[model samples]
Target: MRIGLYPGTFDPITHGHIDIIRRASVMVDRLVIGVAINRDKGPLFSLDERVAMLTDECRTLSEQTGVDIVVHPFENLLIDCAQDVGAKIIVRGLRAVADFEYEFQMVGMNRALNDQIETVFLMAEARHQAIASKLVKEIARLGGDVSKFVTPPVHAALRAKFS
Candidate 1:
């Protein structure tokens, strides 16, 4: 089966993330959402919380796409995470040229680590192009409405977190 790994900190999954996940599902038989445990990011949500959020979102997506979506948590290298999940392709979401520059370097590093695994980039929808988890968090923290950037559940979580 063709499996793709989409790795992100997912401090709280945003609509932009959901967009990528939805589009990536069609390219692989199974799409593994790799929840990265990057302590350096100082995530707002714990690993379990991130995983739970992804599970809830992915369940609906899997039902809609008719593809199995698995949430896997990892603290290791992204390439290693892909290998662990038996993913031959790594899916990435691109918002702008800035995102591409960083992802280009990552693709090169990942290829150096293992040339067998390929990287695929999916452009975010125009509406979601400006929605980022960090910005969403900042907006929510400042009492601004984040309904546009996240689902109700995530918006609620942010409310609860900031409250």
Candidate 2:
């Protein structure tokens, strides 16, 4: 089976993420949403919370696409995580040139570590290109509407977190 891994903190899975997940699912037999357990980022949501949010968001997408979507939390190198999930492709969502620059370096480093795994970049839809989890959280914290950037469940989770 062609398994692909998409790794991210996913503090609160945004619409941008869902867009990528939906698109990526069709390209692989199984799409593993690797939720990173990066403590350095001080994520707004806990690992379990992030995993739960991703799981909830992806259930429908999985059903529609007929591609198995699994949420796997990892605290190790992304390449290692991919290996753990038997992923030969690493899927990444690109929003802008800035994101490309960072991802380029990451791809290089990951290749150096494991040349077998390939990284594929998917450009975010224009509408979702500007939506980010960090910005979503900031807007929610400041009492702004984030309905356009995230799904209802995630928006409710953010509201509950900040409330």
Candidate 3:
């Protein structure tokens, strides 16, 4: 089976993320969304909360798109998670030139770590090219409307976190 891994902090999964996930699903037998647990980056939501929110959001996506989504929390290295899950490909969404530069570097590192694994980059839809989790959080924290950026469960989680 062609299993793909998509790793991110996903402070809160955005609509852009769901878009990528849906697009990636077309090419892979299974898509594992790995939520990276980074100690350096303090997120708006806890690991458990993020995982739960992602699970819920993905459930909604499955119903809407008829694609199976598996969400996993990873404290170890991404390559390790991919290896454990038997994922031979890593999927990433590129939004801008800067994102390409960064993702390219990570792809190289991942290749070095696992020579058999390959990284695939997908461009975010034009309308969502500028949306990101950090931006979503900033907008929500500032009391601006982020209903379009994040799922309803994520919005509720963010409100509960910031309130």
Candidate 4:
């Protein structure tokens, strides 16, 4: 079975993330969306909240795409998470050239840690490419509309947080 792991903090998963998940899911038998804990980011939503939100968003798609989408929250090394889930591939979304450089570095490190695992890069759809979770949060924090960038649940969560 070809398993792909997509790991992110997902403080609040955006439409761009959904785009990548949808695209990536098709390429693997099972796509595990790892909601990782990023201590550096100190995400707006708690780990449980992020997992809940991601689970809600992926529920229907998991069935429709014929991909077993597992929302697993992890606080350890990414390769360890991949190993635990039996993921042979790691999927990443690239929004721009800058993202490429950063992901390239991480991919190199991941390769060093576990040579058996491979990384694949998916370009974010042009329309959704600019919609990043960090920017979406900032926009909502300042009372700007983020409805277009995120799903209904996430948009509602942002409103409740700022309002």
Candidate 5:
């Protein structure tokens, strides 16, 4: 069974993320959404909260798309996490050229670490390309609306945490 890993902070999973997950699901037998722990950027939601939100968001896709979704919180290296989960592919969403530069470097390093694994970049839908967690958090923190960008559960969680 081919497994893919989509790793990110996912402070709050957005519709764009859901779109990527849905698209990636069609390509892989199993997709592991790794909620990475980034010590650099203090997260808005706790690991448990992020996992809960991701789990809830993925449930609908699970039923509708028949993709086995696994939400795991990882503090170790991403390659290690991928290896642990038996992923032969790393799934990533490309918003623009800038994203490609960074993801390219990581992909190179991951390839060096494990030559068998490959990185697949999927272009984000034009409308969702601008919807990022940091941007959503900033907008919502200032009491602006973000209903269109993120899921309802993520919206609620952001409000509760930032408001």
Candidate 6:
């Protein structure tokens, strides 16, 4: 089976992220949403919280697309995580040229680390190209509504955090 790994800090998975997940799911037999447990990054949501939230949010999409979505929390190198999960493809989302430049460099590094793994980039839809997790958290912290930027579960989590 063509298994794909989509790894991210996923402080709070946004609509833009779900878009990429949905698109990537269609291209692979199974798409594992690997949540990066990078404590050094100090993400807003805890690793377990992020995994639970994303799992709750992705259930419907998995049903609709017939793509098995598993939210796995990981530490250590991401390539190692992918290898552990038997993923030959790494899926990434690109929001703009800036995103491309950064992802391009990382892709080469990931390739150098594991030539057996290939990275695939999915372009964000025009509507979501500007939505970013940092901005979303900033807006939420300042009492701005982010209902349109994230799934309902994520929106609720943000509200709970900021409240």
For all candidates, the clash counts are 0, 0, 0, 0, 0, 0
Q: What is the C-alpha lDDT of each candidate?
A: 0.96, 0.95, 0.88, 0.93, 0.91, 0.92
Q: What is the lDDT of residue 6 in candidate 4?
A: 96
TM-score of each: 0.99, 0.99, 0.95, 0.98, 0.97, 0.97
Count steric clashes of candidate 6.
0
State which candidate, 4 or 5, has the greater lDDT.
4
Model 2: colliding residue pairs: none
Superior by lDDT: candidate 3 or candidate 5: 5
RMSD of each: 0.5, 0.5, 1.2, 0.8, 0.8, 0.8
Best by lDDT: 1
Model 1: CA > 4 A from native? none
After aligning candidate 1 to the native by TM-score, how far in Å is the CA of 13 from where it should be? 0.5
Candidate 3 C-alpha lDDT tens digits along 95-141: 99999999888888888888898899999999999999999999988
Question: lDDT, candidate 4, residue 122?
Answer: 97
Worst 10 residues of 2 by lDDT: 51-60
Q: State residue 109's C-alpha deviation in candidate 1, in Å.
A: 0.8
User: lDDT tens string, model 2, 31-145?
Assistant: 9999999999999999999989999988999999999999999999999999999999999999999999999999999999999999999999999999989999999999999
Model 4: per-residue Cα lDDT at residue 114: 99
Q: lDDT per residue, candidate 1, 1-163, as tens digits?
A: 9999999999889999999999999999999999999999999999999999999999999999999999999999999999999999999999999999999999999999999999999999999999889999999999999998899999999999999
Cα miss at 159, model 1 (Å)?
A: 0.2
